[model samples]
Target: MDRRHCLVTGANRGLGLEFVRQLLARRHHVVATCRHPGKATALNTLAGEYPGRLHVLPLDVAEPRSHAELARELALVTDGEKLDLLVNNAGVLRGSERFGHVQPADLEASFRTNAMGPFLLVQTLASQIADGGTVANISSEVGSIALRQEFRTPSYAIGKAAQNMATSLLAQALESRRIKVVALHPGWVQTDMGGEQAALTAQESVAGLLQVIDHLDEDDSGGFLDWQGQTLPW
Candidate 1:
């Protein structure tokens, strides 16, 4: 694969951080974003090791103003260069509070961060994304209404489901530009949110996901898929 310029959100830790590591290892230029640059010790350390290849930016995904700010900053940094990949990997998982006990604030927070953030980011940066570039929105099987067997993680589920819809809508909207947008399930990886008992490690999950992303095309846009490139029932 040719070297590409990539941007990943929530890149200070867990799956997001792993994505940065692997992308940099593949020799791709990467812009890694987190809400707080000062506290991103690991990410900043990686920046030192990778030198000019890695750039870290502060981004608060839930804030619309932050989205606008990031777009402007990136436009200047890239200086007309287009982004080959945009990974909407930043997300939050409020615990599976029972329906009656679910807090409206938690639900709103989840939706803002997990759903609206990614959707707005795409909208703000669409022009900077290369024609035919790929947008991978990290989603989960829990978001699939067809697969729902229990009521758990309502806030997280709702947000991810909305994220899935955003991916579909963006795929259709960006079709003229040949930009492929798709939702992906990274599996139950052992991240802060996934917990230690999770079946997969961050490295394992991201490795499979990168493979899936590598092969995505216009035909795959608007589809929901797992890390192994398997089609998921929406």
Candidate 2:
């Protein structure tokens, strides 16, 4: 395979960090972003290990200004080259929310980070993405309305559901360029967010997700899928 340029958001830890590691292992050039690059010790360490192959930058996904700044910085990093993949991995889940006690702040934060941020980020960076590139939005199975069995995590659920719509719309918006956009569930990952008892480790989930991403065809754009490449109802 040709060496590809890729970018990953919230890449300081967990699945995002694993994505960066795996992409670098595959010999792809990567730009990894987080809210505070200076505070991202692991990513900074990876930058040393990978040398020029990895670049860690700052990005707060909920903020549009940060997106613009990232765009500017990305241009310099890629040196006019286009990116082959963009992973929208920054997300928030207010695990404390109950039905009546769901805070407005939680909802707003979740919506901005989970739904609006990814959509607007893609729009901002559309020109930077190569023709036939891929956009992978990290989503959750709890976002599935059809699969809902309880009222747990309303804020997260709602945000991801909206993100699902955003992914669909982006697929349409970028169809002419053949940019494949899809929402992917990383499964019950054993990350800080997923907790220690989750079904899969970050390495396992990211490995499977990468395989799924690598196999995506034109027909797979705008679809919802799990880490193992299984289709999930939207």
Candidate 3:
């Protein structure tokens, strides 16, 4: 296969960082983006260790203008070459302060990051991914209305639901180009967002996700798939 090039947003830490590390281990070219590259010492250090295998870029998902700027910069550098995969992993989950006391501003911010950010990121990079590439939206099981078992994350739930919608809508738009688009629920992972009681570790979650990704095809486009490869109901 040709050398794989992927762009992973929010790759400073957590699952995003893991994804970059794992992909780099596979000898793929990875563009790891974060809001503050200055503070991302770990990523920058890894970039140095891997040399040409890694490229760290500054990207703030909440900032719309940043996306276009990144596009122009990458285009200038690569001469419009297409990226093989884009992992829309930048997101925020503001735990609603208390049970019914959710802050409206926080909710909006959550939507901006989780929903609007990924949507805009994909839109901006649509031309950068070749016709037959893939896109992964890092969503959560809490967004699953069909599987809701009394989870109380109002802001995160709403944003992820919208994010899943984007997954389908993007699939529809890219279907003609044979690009596979889908949302991958990383599971209740033991990350900063997943908290202490979470059952699965980030490694386990991302492992399952890559497996599901390994099996995806155009027919699987628009589907909501759990990390375990199970189909999820919208």
Candidate 4:
């Protein structure tokens, strides 16, 4: 199980934490990052429980400076450079404002966290990853044009759209190195973001996502897929 180390952003709680938990269960070392790790008692407990297997790093994906620090930390962790899977999971929503009520500032915040953040993370961490590494951008089906509707989160929708495009662009660019890139939509799950009305539980959604990751291959790279393995429309 020493294939490679995993770094998951937004790993303080919700699906991100669940992803870390599941990966650890599979005997994979996980570097879970959050903006405020000081108060993340659950993550601290996991780190304690797993010893060297679970590492909790303080990171804010929305901040570019943190990317440099994360790089430095990875260098120390791997001697020079080595991390297998990099999951771009950190994201934000501005109080769930409706479409008509979507503030420009709110849209800016959404795009920054959902789209630009992931893009920057990939750009900064590309060197830290070994060849043939995998990057998963936790995207959403709401970004699907073919599946479109007047949603409440225009900014979120647009951001995921950009993220999907980034996924495709990076996939082709990194194709020669065999670095797989994918936009994964974890199905409607109960979380602070997903709200209580969402269908799937966080456990179930993350479990499905992990299953999809476990089955990833070179051919599957650049694909926009749901947690259930269904291909999504652009």
Candidate number achieving the greatest TM-score relative to the actual structure: 2
Write down the lDDT of every candidate, Cα atoms only: 0.94, 0.96, 0.88, 0.87
Which regions of candidate 4 deviate over 4 angstroms?
1-3
The residue-by-residue lDDT of candidate 1 on 107-210, one tens digit each, is 99999999999999999999999999999999999999889999999999999999999999999999999999999999999999999999999999999999
Q: Write down the TM-score of every candidate.
A: 0.98, 0.99, 0.95, 0.95
Number of residue pairs clashing in candidate 1, backbone atoms closer than 3 angstroms, sequence gap of 3 or more or interchain = 0
* Model 3 agreement with the true structure over 6-114: per-residue lDDT tens digits: 8899999989999998888878888999999999999999999998778888898989999998887777545467888899999998864677688889889889999
TM-score sort, best first: 2, 1, 3, 4
Compose the digit string of candidate 4's lDDT tens values, residues 88-179.
99888665667567788877887888888888888898888768889999999988888886665778888888889889988888899899
* Predicted structure with the largest lDDT when compared to the true one: 2
Model 3 regions more than 4 Å off: 76-79
Q: Cα RMSDs of all predictions?
A: 0.8, 0.6, 1.4, 1.5
- Which of the predicted structures, 1 or 2, would earn the higher lDDT when compared with the native? 2
